[model samples]
Target chain A: MAGYQDLVLRVNLTTGKVATESLNKEWARDFLGGKGLGIKYLYEEVGPGVEALSPENKLIFMTGPFTGTIVPCSGKLGIITKSPLNGYILDCSIGGSAAVEIKRAGYDAVIVEGKSDYPVYLLIEDGQVELKEAGDYWGLCCHDTEEKLKKVYGDDYSVLSIGPAGENLVAYACITSDLYRQAGRGGVGAVMGSKMLKAVVVKGTGAVRAADAKKLMDVTYNAYKNDLLTDTNLWAYTDGTPMIVELSQTTGILPTRNFQQGTFDQFANIKSEAVAAAREAKKGCVSCGLGCGNFTRVGEAVVEGPEYETLSIAGSNCGINDLGAIVKFNANCDAFGLDTISAGGTIAFAMEMTEKGIYDFGIRFGDADKYVELPELIAKREGLGAELALGAKKLAEKYGGIEFAMQVKGLEFPGYDPRGAWGMGLAYATAPRGACHMSAWPVADEAYGEGNPFTIEGKAEMVKDLQHYNAAKFSLILCDFWALSFDIMAEMLSALLGEEVTAQSLEQAGERIFNLARLFNTREGLSAKDDVLPARIHRHPLATGSTEGKTLPEEEFIKMLLEYYSIRGWDNNGVPSGEKLQELGLR
Target chain B: MIIIELRGPLARYGCEHGEKGRIEAKADNGVTVRQILNQVPIPLQHVGLIVVNGKKGSLQTMLSEGDSVVIFPVVAGG
Candidate 1:
């Protein structure tokens, strides 16, 4: 309550009108903030059967308590809406200045409803908000759009814009920001485009004061300044996340060639060193001294990425080891405003389909030369890319190869191959936002030997705990990488809120958020059967490495899920029980 | 004897490149992977992915003759 501005601007684009509303203090107390708050809003507004891409679907961009604070890695902004990709409650958070800028703009969140008569962009400067005509910016790619907006609004305004992909309503289109980071899951961008909205530009110079600012600042500064000494943060700052390339591949969980294999033969080419060598310099999110975003020098121009997901999907999964080609493809996706992981996964699925002779789509793994132009084609809805833009599961279903779609709950898989890590398999299947890794990342437990990746003995408890805590962190809009130690995090939160927020309370908040997401999904018709993994993960054994001859045992997974559900206060069917919901004050 | 090249964080003191190191002593006296690491001046705690002859190998795995090893530090990413 102390850090919050206690106000939100609701814009009804159809009527070109804007109205301000007082913050629901009770809801804030119940849901906390960020993804949790956004879901609460969606649950109240959207009904069970509303079409995701329809104008009826409301898009909420919400941040949290620590967003504008001096917390480390607090640049995440959550995009909450009914996803066209999966028809589920989508809470995709991206790292950028948008969350910070919006929070600083004297508001806790921005909720846009109804359809605009024409393409438009929202400009929020402090308390003043304007809906600007985006007729000229409609057809522009994300990079150009951001450049134009920045030029117009100077360097101060943080822009979250969609490109040709979103404009065309590509199912996996991304909402790009800072020309790099994106809310890149589900079809949130498609929902944005469907409403005839293009971008949200914000520039706020206002300051946020926490309940105990001095204590908060002191605690945060000590941790932030000492974060380099920590294992995860230090490693992250040194090599960026792409350094996991060798580790994952060596661990045999790299999700190679549409996840047919765990390890890649050409792993060296997609290594962090290669990515670093290809880059101009490190880049990342707002207020982040550690710039993890890569600016790869591919021939004539320096472009972004071959980040971990992009590297796995575009490189090993696609069979393309050429870092330059991967960089170019990643940059191409960025410009076109498409999710690179989905694009890469979709293309990889297509290539696999092509290999099976199911369709002569002319796709193949490692065919970097051919796929460099695929992003533009997908954004423009051209060629086979039209189908590719529909995302992996749909493309696979259309091509009659749903078995190897490499998707979970209609969302394409991230980088980790489940065979190599069983915990990741559970995480993928049980994630609230489809196949997202962030929902409950068991990477350390699964891939790295941090807490034992292979042991399913106590993994259910770990996953449940992580899911809850992470959900809570998402409400705080903090980076999961920095949530290395929950005890430290609890102390920080307590210091900021001047509340006795123990680890248990944080876990409880996360549980509440998780249940709320489930509640929304349940109301939207997601049943017990929806919680499932692809057949490939169940049937196939890892071809090479430490986990060779290993697969996510179906019975083990079922038992794990049941145990997870039990811990989550859910029924045998994985639905949150009435008692549990009541306990969380959701009922 | 297998030679292990250490890179990234392991090459802390000397250079920015990987250290061209050697593992002269083999498993003649039944030396385990952990013991061989102890023989080396540098510690193995930070090393994450261990590649022995282009395949994934753990610390428990015994060293074989003529094996080419690559030791990487525990870094980030998935």
Candidate 2:
């Protein structure tokens, strides 16, 4: 309780009412904060059959106990809501100073509900909160809106805004903060657009108190020197995510040509070295020592990343090797507030559709010129962009190419090709928020480590454990870049809360949180039937590179899924059992 | 001579021997990957994946002269 502000801010745009309430201490104790806490709020406030874009769907912004503290890599803000794209429980963590600002504003969470008659932006300055008219800022891009808001509110405020993509209700529209960082999946921004809330700006000067400040500082400083700034975690600063491009290529998991192949011939042109060569500076989130962001400029394009996901899905998956073009595409997505992974996956699917004469959008693999122009069109919902805005699953549904949509549960696949790392297939399918890589990343152990990439022997346990680990970690709002173990997290939590916290307790909390999310999804009618990979993953084999002739056999995938459910104490239908629910106190 | 490539922070190991990221090491035919790694300053835990001739290689993987070995750090997240 010492690490918490113990306050919640609720704003109803339709009624023009803003009120503050005490934090749900029982829920906070059980779910902690960030993803877990945010999802718990959504499950309680929003009903099972709520439409994601309707006013009934609430948008919750949450911060964790570690936020605004000296805990390194704890600056990520969690946004939770029903996904407009997939109609599932969606939670996304974005890096920036927003979490710190929100916490300093003396609140653990901010809940925005209902729709405004006109465009408005919520401004919270210390204890003062008001809904201001955003008519002048409504049509601008994410960057311009942030810049204009900063001009009026001064630079000390943290701003989160949407762009044309969100305004047009693009299915994969994302929310942008700090100019570049985004809650970049599952149409959270579309939900914001639906409420006609263009931005949320916060300026807080309060401090987050710790229970044992001396012990917390000692742990923080020790971890900062011994655990955080070490060889195990320095890769974030040294090469960042671009290093994974080569690793994925070498291990035969790099998605290429819409996943028809596992390797790209032009991978060298877009690897970490290429990013470093174009790097102008390094950036990081608040309270971060290992700045993973590489600010790169190529010709007229300037952006923070074109990270591994963008580099793979937009670069090789599209058969376009031009790094400059990929950078331009990345800048376009940031400007338009579109999720790059979904945008790129949809385009690649379209390219294959065009090549196969299914439905030609006049775009093909390696068409860099046409590829760079699609994001804006999609954001504006004009011309071919209108069709592309539907995303891969919806496009495939409207059209006739469902098998190769490269999506699971309506969300597009990330960079790693699942055929090469079989556990990834399970992770993607079983992810609560559609096909999200952050839910669990077993490829790091299988394709990137000493584990066998082609086996399902320990994959079920591995995926389940990793999923629980990630769920708990994200709930604490820690940055994924830190590879600290559960013990470190428990130690920090114990110090901050003035209580005994153990790794075992944290792991149990993780299980409880994961089960609660499953309950949310199942309540909305998602079940084992929805936990499925694209047909191409089961049917198509890669034709080149180290993973040549490899496919995740359908039988092996099913065995893994069933085994995963068994290990998770779930029934054959992937529902948590009564005994398991009772054990987690969810009964 | 076997050409060894080190990536990310693991490049420090290669720098200890020959170049910054690349090292030309003398190894006999049929030498194991563990043996080659022992000759370097890198801790085995620091090595995430070992690749030999574009394929995944284990610690016991046999190494021959003129082979190419790439060592990566145990860093994963994006």
Candidate 3:
């Protein structure tokens, strides 16, 4: 495959050795790339229940065949590892130039294993690879660290670095790149921190060799570009995700007051219209056309988002609808290298705990004056920040109020409240990296799907198809916004690999990846019980908004899961049978 | 008079008519949202959700005087 460099860079930090190996063509064909190939590597080398931050585990940095090519929205870097926040096999896909830089640097994936005795950072320029001492750059925040690297390596280098949160081993820490873009979930940053690796800087002057450059460019410009320029995409381009503030608000799914309700009365104050006024600049990721990132000004600090998830969790859910405050809060998290979703969800949990008299951090819902001070403490594991740094699951475990912790499998949910869209409920439950919307965004179709968004019937099917499609696309690693249809993915993959791989085959590959992730978890003692939603979602019916008085019936939801499991060739316990594995060639 | 607030690109139609987003138009009490949308210059496909007074309503939903309609596009986010 011309698109794939067919090289895997193996770095042993402890041994201080680096080796370049030929790509496993068979695994590449079976697993595809990105998350798919990512899991294949992680699954093979790491033991079933290996400690997440252990040197025994490998951090696989992967890029797809479309990466570094003319493919729109293709600069996706997949960070695959056992999560320090949760025990699931996690693949956090981040957008930026790093993936493209990695691909152009002559490697499909870079598997970094073994812990370093001292802090170091890996630098890759074309084929030249070296592990340089990073002690001087260790404690800098994400933004400052990137600036320091850019000063030394020049602007051409694409740096993926961590910050104080990672250095301090914040459980929900994330890896930052391209300034604000991140592999933001599942504590992948902590994994990097544990390895004593500060950053992976790549400078690629070489062009990615695509299978058929003309065909790839033609299809990219003609089909994907034409469709993306339409009105729907125009909205994304203009407002980015700040528009979701209104959509979620007007539809009564804004995730307000610790998720006790779905509507936030103050939504207008923090919505797209408000954010647009504060927008100092629009940021685009690598090869991105839909560029939805907002670099908005708040006070003297100019920060990227406090996007939908941050706005919802830290804004509405925390009972603070001040957009500027949210922006500052967002900047603090990015500097501290915390996952904004997890950090915001954690604060919301603490507020609810204070309300319930379970614990007091002097926080309250509809009031977040204290949150601005929490991120730094959380990153440093200082004072109450230490307890709160454990995340919602562990906090709720120790202090009580587990019912409203707003987390699944130790991962916090995004802004979408599931009562309004039932498919999201299933998506949250079944996500391999815990309650992640990226696993598959059924909420998109469900919110826009025909008839009632409240319908239970066909939600399972919609979630299933999306999971498979996204799973496959994750390896091709196209952004969901880019993968509007499978035809585009199939055509591009075929053109890139110079093979006639259809969307059908690609989706099949996705199913294989999903199953493999499940297998990794099951091997680590995952059960059907793990495939369950938070009790708050099932029991607490929304008291206000579009989904007022709606909640998932627990037994019915289980039945739906059973149907989904059966559809996916799994048994009652949500385990994929041997025949299914054989079918995917995973056997 | 029925008040309809247009969002995203759907605002373009109202903008062309010298109305900024929120357009006031007369419609019979029982007219479907589809009918009102058809009367507007906007391409109906661009409108994903038709929220009537803060609730998700379908195109076939009946519209009435004093009822506010907010139309949004079917775009996605992370």
Best by lDDT: 2
Rank all candidate structures by their lDDT, best first, as comma-separated numbers: 2, 3, 1
DockQ of each: 0.31, 0.69, 0.54
TM-scores of the models, in the order given: 0.94, 0.98, 0.97
Give the number of the best model, judged by DockQ.
2
| Model 3, docking class | medium
Candidate 1 vs candidate 2: which has greater lDDT? Answer: 2
Stretches of candidate 2 off by over 4 Å are B16-19
Q: Can you write out model 2's per-residue Cα lDDT over A172-277, one digit (the tens) per residue?
A: 9999999989999889999999999999999889999999999999998998999888777888998999999998999888999888889999999999999999
Model no. 2, DockQ: 0.69
- Measured as a fraction from 0 to 1, the native contacts recovered by model 3 come to 0.49
How good is the docking of model 1, as DockQ?
0.31
Best TM-score among the predictions, by candidate number: 2
